[model samples]
Each structure stands twice: as structure tokens, then as C-alpha cells.
Target: MAERGRDEESGKFTEEYPKEDFIKALKELESTGTTDIAESVGCDRRTAYLKLNILEEENKVESKKIGNVLLWELAVESV
Candidate 1:
């Protein structure tokens, strides 16, 4: 389920979509842009971008920029 909470900085309600939704989206899409990710995960583009950044920081996913768009995919594990 999505969680709605107040943003400390803005004091406005914010909705948190599940990280699993993102992971699953990446799995299904293989590689995609933020707009596609948002659509697949049922959220807005900004939310998808933020979550993708978090996942990138955690090393769970990787990304590369192609012209003006960023392409995302699950991280490849090395042995």
C-alpha cells in the first residue's frame, strides 16, 4: 500500500510509492526512462526519478543518460 505523510520541508502531504513497484517495473521493462517507469509504477515522473536515484545510491540499479533522457535498469552483479 502507498503511504501518505507530511513533508518536513514543505509541510504538505506526500505519497510514497513502494520500492518493490519500481523493482518490478525495471524487471519487466528491462531498461526504460522515468516517464515509462512512472507509468509502470503508477506514480508521477518526479516520484519515479527520486526513487530511481535512491535505488542507484543503494547499488540496486544503474543508469545512463542518453541525450536528454536517463535510462535505468537493474544493477548487474559481478562475481
Candidate 2:
């Protein structure tokens, strides 16, 4: 089992959260920045990016440049 540690910021025991949790969070938003995703999921920005990377690789998400920031959203499908 992974060792549990108290998070410095939340002071709560931190455990592994599945990547799907991030995906679910992203689906609820039309578009979002990296920091917003981290805040929404109660994780660090780096973890959020990691999950986003996986989602992008799986073609579940897409991103576009908006100014200097990247906005990500669920990939749209066409019939």
C-alpha cells in the first residue's frame, strides 16, 4: 500500500486518486486552464497536468492556445 501522508496545505491524509476523476471533472467544464482543474480536483497542478496528458493521449481531450494559457476541453465528436 502507498504510504499516506498529511498534505501540507489541506492537512488531510493524501491518497492516490484515479486519473478518471480528473476526466470526470474536465467533462463538466466547457474549457478550463490547468490551475482551475487542479483546484477543482483538490490536487496539485502537476498532477492535473499528468492526468491531462493521459487524456490527451487517449484522444479524450483537446486544448487550444488562448493568449499565453492553454484552455482544455472534452474532444468533440462528429457523426
Tell me, by TM-score, which candidate is best. Answer: 1
Q: What is the lDDT of candidate 2?
A: 0.80
Residue-by-residue lDDT tens digits, candidate 2, 16-68? 76666777778776689988988888889998888888888888888888899
Question: Which pairs of residues clash in candidate 2, taking residues 3 or more apart in a chain or in different chains?
Answer: none
Whole-structure CA lDDT of model 1: 0.89
Deviating ranges (above 4 Å) for candidate 2? 1-15
Error of 2 at 10 (Å): 30
The count of residue-pair clashes in candidate 2 stands at 0
- Alpha-carbon runs more than 4 Å astray in model 1: 1-15
TM-score of 2: 0.71
On residues 1-79, what C-alpha lDDT tens digit does candidate 1 reach at each position? 6567998999988656878889999999988999999999989899999999999998998999999999999999610
Model 2, position 36: C-alpha lDDT score: 91
Measured over all alpha carbons after superposition, the RMSD of each candidate to the real structure, in angstroms, is 5.5, 7.6
